[model samples]
Structures are given as structure tokens and as C-alpha cells.
Target chain A: MDKIEEKELWPEEKSLMKAEISRRKFITSATLAALGLAMTPYATLAAAPSNKPVNFASFVEINTTINGQNMKMKLDPRTSLLDLLREQLGLTGSKKGCNQGACGACTVHMGKDRINSCLTLAAQIDGKEVTTIEGIGSETEFHPIQVAFMEHDGYQCGYCTPGQIMSAIKVLEEDHAGSDAEIREWMSGNICRCGAYKGIVEAVKSVRDETYDKKLIKRTQQKVS
Target chain B: MNPFQYSKAKSADAAINGYMEHDNTAYLAGGTNLVDRIRRDVTHPDYLIDVSELPFSKIEKIEGGLRLGAMASNSDTADDENVKNDYPIVSEAILLGATDQLRNKATNGGNLMQRTRCSYYMSPHFACNKREPGSGCDAIDGHNRILSVLGTSEKCIASYPSDMCTALAALDAVVQIQTPNGGKRSLPLVDFRRLPGDSPEIDTNLKEGELITSIDLPESSKAFAKASHYLKVRDRHSYAFALVSVAAALVMENNMIKDARMALGSVAAKPWRDQEAEAMFIGKKPSRELFEKIAEKTMEGAKGYGENDFKIELGKRAIVKAFMKVAGLS
Candidate 1:
């Protein structure tokens, strides 16, 4: 429906295709009309494909806030937001055990909503607000959840501590996860391979029961709403 | 894994043309499934066409049901207001798939295209015909406890891993594709993923130049809104893939079945939507025997070898459990 699809192709008869033109050259990629990548050949293996312009996932500039910190970065579309923060932005607090969404090791808050940073692409983070483990509070002023995790001994090997913290923050955002069993069910995604689950549960319960503040609730409510 | 070229497609034709130009061009959206695989060397696309910027990111109520852009992330779709009220089954299925973080980044199209997580498939060193055709299928003779007994062959035994897809298939979605002719086509959700026939390499019937643009779904059913749920059983709690899963929607008129739809995942070559099983419940009441019979009908063609024989029973149990919930007996 755009200018590209609307463009009329100058006639190139399909009948003119030479039968003996080697199977390697006959892959006949669908890029007969593209403008980004096929224009030039890639390495030797795919050299037989058409000369139409092809494109790969490109780098883009994203201006966003992470953990109340506003920052800008030029990131490859393929670079997950979790990697961008943990690897590129010097935010080493986030962990990465199961990168494919299974283990919730790389959890972060985005626009007040907690999300698994590992599955999120940096480009998708543009114009949104993100909060990493480093963003929660300064050493002089620890976030209540952070203090609770520390006090509750909410970690053993500590690989999943950051993600556990993020999940606990988002637990209040969800309306369904209630009761100790529900909390356990909701927090189940953030696995502690070290079997530090009891500590993680205690850390979450401590925040929910005693230290949950109106200010934190307000921000989370605004996000959930 | 390798340093590949990247491009953000402005049009569907541009994406298709990009694919035509390179033998290894793959459309990158969400990258939840593809990126991890690439890191493990499961997929080796030399050129990645960025389609996230294309119009395929929108999730709106298009026809009677919702029209989800191919790039519409699972978290967004699960969180959409219309989806919550109208297509709750879709939302529920997505929610049951992964955690909030993963759902936020997984696209509907990419979710369906996710490769099976058969241990053999992920271990690139193992023999997996799905990863490398004719490499020799190790799962057939190996530990394939969670594999597809339905629509499976000796060539492959991996079960589809996306929990969201199980519900989408039950809802009768349509996948929109723009082909090389600049003409658009749609494949039914049930027929999108090719069965593990002789060639496990071909996952979908998609032609060489086709790019999935969106998924057009049918009208949201009242049954789905009133009584629908997805149940998955796995070794670990939240983060692991399903060992046996069920996506079911049922409506009852005075305790008699008025309508039913059921799909199974994590124990099939694809998300298995069986109308035959649904037929057993069309006019029947939910009873233990009736539920067992319905489950049996679903596995009418199940054929398993090696470690997956137990899945047949697990698959039946999972669907029965869903019926119990639908019947409000639980």
C-alpha cells in the first residue's frame, strides 16, 4: 500500500530463467524489489542471490530513563535492553543466567512497570523509562526492597538477587498474586538455581507487610493503571 | 552468532525483497526466540531484516476479532484492553507462556516461529534434523520425554514450545503474509506450522519470499470470555517450558456442552487443536468418564516412540484438568 509496493516493476520475464544456471544461483531470493540489502553481495555462500538492496538489523538511538536515570544510547536492534544495560551501560547489577526468558535473572523496571530486561530489545526501549538494579537507590539511600533483601538474607550465590528484587517490586503491580502461595507462584519465574527461594520469599513478604509505602504504591498504581 | 548485516524494512515488499537477495535473510522482530538460538548457533542468518519499525507493530481491533501486527509483542497483546476483555484466552495463553519481561518482548509471529526446545535441538552438538536436516535425529532414540506423539515422524520429535500459540490455534487465527508477487496471503493458524513430516527442516508452508505481516483472528467467542484457561505442567515452576499443556475454551448450557475448543502444546509437533475431541463435548455433560473419552479422542492418532510414550497420558490428563475447570468442578 506504500510507494514501494505501488511501484511498477519493469518487466523481467520469468521464462527467461536459464534452467542450467546452477542450483546455487537459482535460489532466486524474494528480494527482486527490495532496496536495503541485496544491492551488494554478502559473503561467498549467498553470492548467487539477487543484487537487490537488502538490510540487516540496524543500530538505532534510544533516549530513555533507566532506574530514574535518563540516558541515550546507539544500540543494535538485536541487542537486548538487558545486554545494553548490563554490558554497555556499566550496569552490572543485572544478571543473565537464562537469557531466553526462562530464568528471570535480568529483570528491570520500565516506565514504572517491571519487565524481564533480557527479552527486551534496546531499540524498543526508546521513549520509555527504564529502571535497572543500579537505578533503585544510592548506597547512602537504599530502596526499601533492597534493604529488605539484604536484611532477609534473600540471596545465596546472589545470581538471581537482582531479578528477585525486581519481581518483588512488580508483585504489587499485579492484582492477582495474593497470599504466600500466590506470591510464591508469581515469583516462581525468577529462579534461584542456588535454592535461595526461601530468602527471596522472605524479602518480598517483608516489603509487602511492613515497609510498603504510599509513594511506592502510587507510582506502581500509575503504571498498572 | 556471526556479525551480520541489518536493515529496518519500511514496507512488506522491502522485507520480501530483502529475503530474496540473501539466502540467509531472516526477519527480526522481538528476537526473543531467534537471538538466543543464534547465540547457541542454532540459527545462522547472514542478514537480518529489521521489521519492528514496519506497520506490523500495531495491535488493534481490526475485524470482528483483533488484528495483531506480526511484530506486536506478546506482553503488549496480553496487556491490551480489548484482548483482556474480548480475547481473554489469547491473553491468558500469553501470560502462561513466560514472565512479564519475556512477554513484553516476544511478538505473536515470532512466538509461533519459536523453535522447539528439545534438549537435542538446543545442544547444537547433538543430532537434530530440525536444526540441520538429515543431521540424524537424536531425540528419536534418546531422552525425548516431552515430544510430539501426534503429527510426528522419525525425522524429528520436537514439540512446539510457545504456550501462547496453543491458545491462538484454538482461537482460529490467520497469519497474513506478503509474498514475492507483492500479493498478500493468509495461512490458517492450525495450518501455519508444518508437521514433522519427512522433512522437519520446513517449519511452515511459507514460500521463499513471504513475510508474515499480521495475524487476523476470528470473532472472539463468548465461550472464551466466560470459561477459558491455559494449564501447563513442567518440572520447574514458572520459567521452564511445558511438559504438557492445554488451552481450552468451553461453554455450557445448563451443564450440557454448548461449544468447546481445545488445543495442546509441549507434546505435539505443533500446537495441536483437535476438533474431534471438541465434538465429544458438544452435547455432553462434564463427567470423569466423558472427560476421559474426550481426552482419548484428542489422542486418537498419537504415536510415540522411546521416552515420549508417557506424554500421551500426560497430554490427556492436562486436557481433562482444563475441562474440570471449564466445568467449574474444580
Candidate 2:
């Protein structure tokens, strides 16, 4: 606990995260107190501990910026970037589908490249910038890809949408979205069990060609204004 | 997932020292395969040394050909202008194997060092001699549609799953290694990976604590720079391992084959190269009959298990088709 407290937050995101962390801590403590349960070291609100006590001695410290918020954390070496985002930082936008590299539901941008967060350890992300689904445009200001997805009805269950969007963004930036077949090949890593590939390809193509409904984007921009 | 200690090495010597000092230490480069295996409980290490930031990530023009850094990511290596122009087979093989995201994270050295995708070797419930040395073999009698047919021993038959190495084998690339004593040595890429003859546990000829620094493509390989193709046959069109892949390059002069290079992937414990079979192509005119005969000769002595018996035929067809494309016969 002392080790986690010693970690510092970058000034811009400090107050927001501090308040969020305090509320979560309070809720955890109250729940444990109501149950009259002993505080398991692994379940404390400060940070998620490793399952084995042997790992506590080797908690690796990392300085990273996630979703544009600079954070310094001492993480269990076993904690993947996905776990660090969802478990410790309350950023659940990055879903954990397979918790393996086969499924790209945990895709996120690490230094301009879309990578499998589940396969990447938190210890490896030191001095790197990570961007998750939550870091993109807000509700009022939807990113072009988000608007395109909506316009094309790109998702059925929507579980794989975040990962699809993240990969699609790179597909455009890398100039791989020039054709539907190219988009499909580039986006093959992220699987949509609902078989929504046609819509996903259309959405990515629309975004690349700037062909998404301009009226919808105008409404979003108006809301932002 | 197992908990381990992680440290970053600032230099090659420091990385070697870290490996020498620690027991059961793995050099983490890209961590695409190592981390996945750790999560699967296939292999466990007490410490992980970060070697991804090493200075060996540059692709430079050397005396003969190109020197590709071991730590360079597969995407960067494939997209490199020199590799694309001089070694198109390497780019095609690398790009066709994995998805875009994986290509961005997987390094060339790590791709060569990756383990097989055999089902028995992957799951703990099944008996696998490669994962555990005296455990017994399950893939021998089990479903092995994706296993090897060319290089099967009584001990193990796990196919080496790498596309880049197949092209490297065809090109006769050499691996540069830095020993623990700061001495350097180079080995032909064909001899780097070993067959699973008596020992399936050891995959490569690399000794303990030795680090791969780069791979050199000899200038002599430019002979086949114009006509080369990598044909991979998989269950899916993308994002899957190859069942049988053929890498072929041919040099033609006046309608006669001047020089030829060929290698097979996902059909053996290592990249399958048959110089004797390739030699037959020299001075021969391009023909379907000649290609068929050479393909047969290349696949000689190949024995497949029940499910993978089709690979022998598939391998022959892929070889023929690859040669046809390379020679512009079809």
C-alpha cells in the first residue's frame, strides 16, 4: 500500500483520477466492512496484487501515459496492459475477450501501432504512450470512425466494436483502407463473432474515403459547438 | 500468468550479463510468443530481461547483401524499401503469415525462435515430448492435420511454424550471433534450426546465453531477385498458420534454368531445403512434367501420419505451382 501511494500522477489527470480512486477505495472498504471480512491483500483498493505472495517482492515500476493521462505505477509483473487498464485504472473500454493474442478484443494503440493489450505486460509499457477506446472522441464529438460505424451499422453485439475501431483507425492511417478487401485483410485480427464483417468493412472504407454521412457529423459537431 | 522479475538492459553486453547472471531468464523481444507461452504455462521463467530496446534494430547495406537487425519488427522489416526490392519473398512471407497488428509487434528474431502450433504441444492435458522431454507423444496417433509430414521422428513431430525462415532458407541467409564471451559467429540460416531427431527439446543450434544479433542476406542471392514467390496453403485466407508453404526462386537464361532455390515450411521440424532436388532444375527447360518430377524428388522419403498424409500430395502440388509461377510457365 505504501509503495502504491508513493507513485505519482501527472498534474493534468491527477485530480480526476484521485477523486475516482478515492471513491472506489471508499466503496471497497465499506463493502468489506459491512461483510465483516478481513481485507485480503490482493483485494485492497490501492492496486490489484498478484495471486502469489512471491510476486509482491518483485513489483516492477513503470511510468506510462494511458489515454493521454501520465501515470506512474508499481505493477505486479503478471498484470497485462489490459489488466492494468481495466482492473487498476477502471478503464473497461478495452474488453478482454479471449485474454489471448488470438482475439483482438483487447486491441489498443501503443505508440501509433495497434497491439494486443492482453499479450503486452504492463512492465513493458514503461516510457510508452497507450491509447484505449475511452481516449477517442466523446459522446458529443464522435470521431469520424465512430460516426462511420454508426452510419454503416458496423456492429451487431457491439462487443468487438472498440477493438474494430482501434484497428480501423490504424488501417486508415497506414493506407490499408483503400479497398474493402484490403480493409478486411488488415482488420482480420479483430474477430466479430456476430459475423458483422461486411458492415465493419463498409464503415472503415467510408471513414477512409470520407464518405460517412456528412449530416450526422455536422450534428455531432454542432453539439460540440 | 506467472509473476516474474523484469529489467531493461541498456546495452548488448548488459543484456548478456543479465542472462548469464539469472537462472531461467528469457530475453523479451516483442513478447508476442514468449508472453503467450507464459500465460499458457508451457514455459516459465523466473526473470525476463527486456532486450527490445537493443541497438541491433537497424537494417544496413553490408559488403555482400543486406544486414537485417534481429530486433527489427516484422512490419518494418517487410516494409523496408531494400527488402521489398531485393527480397520480395521475405516481405510476402512475413506479410501473409500474421495480421497487421501482429506484424507490428513480432520481431524477426522472435519469429525464428517461435515454437510450433501443434495442438498436443500447446495443451497441458495432452502428452507432448517437445514440451516435456520424456512425456510421450500424442500427436503421433492423434489428429495432426496441421503437423509435419517430412521430418518426423519417434520423439517429436512438431512442425516449426515460421514463414520468414522459409524464405531465408531459400536465400541461404546467415545468422549472426553474439556469444557470452563477446565473440561473434555466423551460421547458415538452414543450419540454425535443427531436426527433432533424438532430442525434440532443443529447437535451435543456439547455445545457452547466446543472442542473435542480425541476419545477413548474401549478395549472391540477388540471382533470383527477379523471379521469386512464396505460396502458403492454410485453412483460411489470412491470420492462420500454414499447412504447407513453398518458397521458390528461379533464374532463367535463354529459356533454360540457370539457377534455382527452393524451401518448404510447415512440413518439417525446420525449413525444408533440398539442394539436390534444386540442382535438377538447373539447365532444364520449364515444363509441367519436369516440375512434377522435381517436386516428387523433393518430397522423397516423406512419411506422414494418418491425418496429415494428404500433406505429402499437397506439398508436391504447392511446390509445382510455386515453381510454375516462379518460372512463368503457368
Candidate 3:
């Protein structure tokens, strides 16, 4: 990736340079833990500018993956991941009820976690993976959570159902999801205007219970093995 | 929203150069915030420089703290075991707001660049100064329930609507940016982003063509790490911007707070980091008396009109509650 520079910065702008230096120190350890590999500075990022000889300006490009597909495109420096998927790439499984990201209709998976696709840009997911409802298996062979949503009758209007299921699936991997209140608290981004919330709750509840059961089964199987 | 020309930047310098060369351009990251604003017609950029691929996508350790690459997805950042274990407040802030889908798509840089989620500004039919300079604001009397009560001008009252940013403010984090010259610098989180003040259109200190490379935390063993909590109060159970949200970190020694950090979200034009509250809580146990005193002091200069008076009460409650949760008081 390319690196850029600025015109001689104000005394204040120069002060901010240390923020990256400070961050790079800790971020390397965390990154190694998560990816189980070392991150080379400027190896992944663009090279730093030679010296200060430019003016201040504000636009840049982002490169990322979308819906389980690797993609590179020119975004309106402001194009959102949700908009690009739905509007540009035509991956419309993610809805756009509230463009401000309050509504979770546009939920999708980024690696192991779920996020509101509406608030993200298409250019930011470079080298990562995304899983939308369309990308999350199929109607015939649904993922465990998707099947659970079906068995639990998880939608009325069904607008928010995709996001709900996506969030629930991600919740299966988290430690903070303990009780019903916890589940509700964590799943707060999705809004079901038809008030299908009870069904949504039940779907998550069923998956969570099954997850616990699976954990127990794994423990037992390990002992048997 | 409006059809525009675009380009993909393979390197960070390319992205910066693309922006430097263009005038009406905006750098796009997660697009979770930027795309919506454009679709709503609030922003109309002529060109977009895509910089999501400049390799600043990982979260890692630094000499002092954690460095969250500018392009790091919120979803990835939220679920990082290190973030969960160390900067739980940051994860909690991300967890408490926005759905899983948006988190995956939104970037830390985008979250920082996000604008106010003002209802009036969102509407193409309404007039807004933030959207169009001197266009006049319809929110003063018209659907003013969710407008900011602090750091707002007569022209714009929109609050910067990022739950994660509020937590960032309290954490006293830093933002790493790459200049068009390729020189790197990091700014204090407080000064990195700006208040609406009079120039409501400008949100950050980022100059055109500059790329936000990452966000970093100070030796974040406590302030952002283990001793943190995020509390949000809203009208509905889900899918609503916080009516009032509190992000706090408190370290207790012998039942008294040794150090405290507090920031309020959704009430001000920018994330409101209450240094006053922090100074007040040091050496004080998080008792009811102390919490009430801190809230009163922070709320001293808070100004609100119309339906937002409830926010003051809610803000107080959220702070107290967040402190208690982090301090394990209740």
C-alpha cells in the first residue's frame, strides 16, 4: 500500500505523530495474539512519507472484502459497505431501514463477529471475510443458527430477521452473553417494528441453549476420547 | 448517494495523493457512517479515494498501548480477545451500540469520522446548516427531541452519534494518522475530533488527504481495560440511539476510587470527556454521595432546551450506574 505525507504540520500536528508510535507498541502484541502472527509495520501499511513537504487534505481510499468475496473498488470516499453491497454489488440480503445504523437490518459477519453493515464501508474490509444471509449457507442447508431461527419462528415482518440471526450466531461465540437480559442487551442493535421480538428472543435463546449443550457434549466426548 | 467517480488505492500514499489532487473528495473507510450520509443526500462528494487496503487493518500491541489500525473493522475490534480482556470498555461500547452487521462493516476511523445522527440532518426534506451552510436549522422547534444540549450552536445542535467514540473519549485514547507526506502522527482523542462550535460542518482536525491510520490506547491495563463499563439508556429496548450513554473506568483501592475516567455520549456535539468528574472521583469511594456530587459538578454548565431536559437526569443516572458497574459497587 502507498503512504503519503503532509505540509510541515503545526506544532500541534507534530504532537499527534506520537499517537501512532504509542499505539504501534501495544497493538503488535494484541495483533499477534489474535492472528497468531507478527505484523510488520509499513509492511502492511503504506510507506511513511519521506519528509513534510505537502499541504493538508482529507480524502483516502479503503480496500476490503465483502460478503465472503474479495473485492477492490473505488468508493465515494464515503461509500458504506452496506450501500456498496446492496446498491453497487447488489448483495441486498442486508436491509437499510435506518441508514444511520440504529437499525440492524443490514447485519453481516466479519470474520467471527457480526456487525451492522449499514454503518461500514465497502473499502474497509480488505483481506477479511464477510458473511451475509446470502453468504451464510442456504435455505436448504442453513447454518445452525439460521435453522434455529426457523424452528423458533423468528420473524413477522422479517425485515430485521437477517440481522437478528446474524447477531445471534455471533453471540454464540461471546462470553458476555449469559442470561436473557444479557442476550437482549447484546442484541439491541436489531429492531423488529412488527414486534416480533419475542420470536427473535426465543430463536437466540434456543441457539444459546443448544450451544451450552454442545459445550457439555464436547467435554463429555473429550473425556470419552 | 449521488453517482460519483471513484478510485481504489493500493497504498496509503496513493489514497492520500488521490485526496490531495481532488477538491470535493472524501476518504471512505467502513462507510457505515459516510455511505448513509451520502445516501441521505447530506454529503455530496465528487470523488472518493478508497484506502481500505493500505495494510492498516490489524490491531496489535505497541510500546505503550494497543494500536487499532485505521481500517480495523469494528466487528473485529469488538471481538478481539485482547480488546475483550484488556479494553473491555471499548468492546462494551461497541457491543452496546450498533448491531453485529454494522460493526463488521464499520471501521475505527469511520467511527471517529461519523457525524451526528440528527433526525433533521437525515431528512432531505428538512433544512440543516450542517448539510448546507446558512440553510437554517429546522430542529430548533421541529423534531428537537434528540438534539444535543451541549456544544451546539444556534445553527446546528446535532450530537456526534458514536457510542464507541464516547468510550474512546473516556479512555483518553490517541488516533494515528498518516499525512500526505507519509509522515505518521497521533493526536489525543480529545483534540483529534472537533466540536460543532460554529463551523458545524467540520467534525475533525483531519486535513484533506490525510488518512486516519489507527486508534491507540495508553498502556491500557486499566482505564480502557479491566475496570470499565458502558451504560446506555434509551427510549426503546433496542435499535435506538442512546438517549444518554455513559462510559466509565474506575480503579478502586481500599474501597476508594484511586483513579476515574468518565465520558458522556449522545448529549454533546462531540464525546464529552468530563475531566471535572475524574478529578472529583480520585481518592473518593464511589458512594452515592460521591457519584451524585460528580454528576452535579459535570452537569453544572450543561445547557438544554425543550424536550431534552430528561437527558440531564438520564445522564446523571447513567454515570452513576456505569461507575457502580465498573467499581463492582452493585
**Candidate achieving the largest TM-score:** 2
lDDT of 1 at B68: 85
Query: If ranked by DockQ, best first, what sequence of candidates would result?
Result: 2, 3, 1
lDDT of 1 by residue, B184-235 (tens): 8889888998888888988888888688888877774644678888888888
Candidate 1 residue-wise lDDT at B269 = 72
Local accuracy of candidate 3 as per-residue lDDT tens digits, B1-330? 455556668888888888888889988776667666666666777777766666989999889988888888887888788778777888878877766556666788888888877766765444567877776676665446677876778878787768888888888889888898879887888777677767777878988677888899878444436578888887876556788888888877787778888888889887888676689988876787788788887777777767677777778777888777777777
What stretches of model 3 exceed 4 Å from their correct place?
A1-150, A157-190, A203-225, B220-226
Name the candidate, 1 or 3, with the larger TM-score value. Answer: 1
| Model 2 alpha-carbon miss at residue B95, Å | 0.5
**Candidate 2: docking tier:** incorrect
Which structure is stronger by TM-score: 2 or 3? 2
Best by lDDT: 2
C-alpha lDDT of residue B89 in model 2: 97
Candidate 2's C-alpha lDDT? 0.85
Best by DockQ: 2
